[model samples]
Target: MLHDAMWDDEFPHDPTICYLNHAAVAPWPKRAADAVSAFARENIHQGARDYPRWIQLEHRLRGQLQSLLNAPGKGDIALVKNTSEALSLVAMGLDWTEGDEVLISDQEFPSNRIPWQALEGRGVTVRQVNLDASDPEAALIAAMGPATRLLSISSVQYASGLRMDLERLGRACRERNILFCVDAIQSLGALPFDVQAIDCDFAMADGHKWLLGPEGLGVFYCRREARDRLKLTQFGWHMVEAMGDYDREDWTPASTARRFEPGSPNTLAQHALSASLELLLEVGIQRIQEALQQRTAYLLQSISSIPGARILSPSAPERRAGIVTFTISGCPNAWLFQQLKDGGIVCAERGGGIRWSPHFYTSQQVLDNALAILRNALQHYNRSR
Candidate 1:
């Protein structure tokens, strides 16, 4: 089926919009959309009479997430509301001392920073390390002190699109006995990720962005050995060992990472995300990475030729991922963003410039059209000024 002539059927984006913002929310694939519709129809008419089937679907999704992260097993994966919730579980779950410190990069999205920052009242200091150096991992390592209890970093900086060397940082944390956590929302579906290879204690990603799924559902992976280290902050029937035994007087959290989930599952989102993940798995992450690399390279080359355009993202291929950010010298970022929006070029204003994030299936025609729009916008800006 993947070898079909019109494989792009999976992503039937509207012709009017040249979408280059996969780093932000993404349009769901046709299969995912179909899955959601079917699930809704089933709910409306059947009222979950086939509820056992839904559970099976959820089980499959856990397995898919497990395979995507190269996690030890499905037992290590938890379905969460979003990346923020997963980070919160880690932030509030850990038993922090008054002087304990959490290290993170200064460029992190608020999802990675705010939760740690919230611990300030508890005398937990959130240290933000500068990642602008030639060796960001080394800078993070140098910032670690005796009080540093955990290092939570993004696999890719949301705005700058700077890809971090998780293996290096993970090794450093291992040697220092610091817990390593990764906010992997940007890299999970765009690049190949291995929980084992990175050796992170916790990792989480939302399904809406690179995963090409709906919002409100995300995956959280916890290393099995570290699961018991963090205290459970929430409790519900679903999180208990005997989940269906509601009348039981004695209960304990499940031994698996599912202990983090404290309420009913998002079964509707499960149908959508499962289909999207299956599509990704069928295509394979390596192919997706290669296609995105080509798109990034093409955008970089084309943008460099435009007068006054300065690429803010890293020039080295290995240092970047799906995102390519740049600025036109004379044009205000807001003005340029408006111009692109008016021209039906769907990009974003980020990292002090305009950011373009194309996915694996983004066509060459869309890139050509968006670049043309950018050139026209720059020309108009220069002329008016």
Candidate 2:
């Protein structure tokens, strides 16, 4: 059980600002900031003197990402610049024929939807399924046709905070011989995610969101058996099987998912992201998930008691992640969002509502303060309207 006392030193957020926007770019942990500072100092004084050690840090990051995703091995993990790049690798690498279809939810962020849509130039069709049904997974599975080659969906809906049944979707895709891909940016750090249990062929997520890392680093997981399914779209010395063998005339792409990475490593970002993952690992994702659930439940209950408040996120606990979205009558989403911002409640206007995403370390006082702000703002706007 994590108490607020445990997080006193980790997140020293501004006293005037109640930051609840972890679903967006997150503030780095103090340890991550410290690591970045040390790396900057080392680079300033003795550049490349510890290059070998930096390589070790990259290896450590790979192992950490592999463990977090419950991947079969470290080789299955590739460090990509962001989730968009990883999704493009899959969308472009796969061989598609005319009329071959790809299935995705209508609620996906542009990162998940646009990649497959780009395939339309190759004669592949992108099918968007509505996930507003009681059984969203069943709706997706039922939408698959004979020509449906892949099914890609977000692990959690970004705007609505709807957590999908990845395991069931993966199983359905496997039985149908269709590849399943998950954009896990929203759930990777907020909850416990198991690629093996879900049996997904591919998963990608940026570290900046719930992982509390920098913006440029992300992890891409490709199952061992599925590694060869996507052909190489990029090539460079770093991705060669014999990475440093400059004298070799013949070369092969790496057997591992490293084949997706085709350039120099982001060493600077590695130091920061590794430290963030270390903090998450030390705290344990299961406990973090529990704390996040508690926060969401509290927010939902409080918002429900507020007159004319409409909760846009799922009402059932099992269907939610760390996001709680709501709209107050008489206050347009845009107007209410600005009012909350004015009150120092950090959140976003998404899906026609104000979305509040609180992490595990968020204090109950912060939640109450944010609610009070929202309540007052709603009343003011209601009177004006």
Q: Which candidate is the best by lDDT?
A: 1
TM-scores for all predictions: 0.98, 0.98
Question: What is candidate 2's lDDT per residue for 1-385, written digit by digit as tens?
Answer: 2466876798986878999999988889999999999999999999999999999999999999988899989999999999999999999988889999999999999999999999999999999999999999999999998999999999999999999989899899999999999999999989999999999999999999999999999999998898898988888988989988999999999998888889999998999999999989988999999899889988999999998889989978779999998887766788888999999999988988889999998888888889888888877887886
After superposing candidate 1 on the true structure, give the runs of residues whose Cα lies further than 4 Å from its correct spot: 1-5
Per-residue CA lDDT of model 1 for 1-385, tens digit only, reads 0122254889876878999999999989999999999999988999979988998998999999999999999999999999999999999988989999999999999999999999999999999999889999899999999999999999999888999999999999999999999999999999999999999999999999999999999999999999998899888988999988988999989989889989999999999999999999998999888888888989999999988889988878788899999998877899889999999988889989999999988988889899888888887877887
lDDT of each: 0.92, 0.92
Backbone collision tally, model 2:
0
Could you tell me which residue pairs clash in candidate 2? none
* Model 2 residue 104 lDDT score: 96
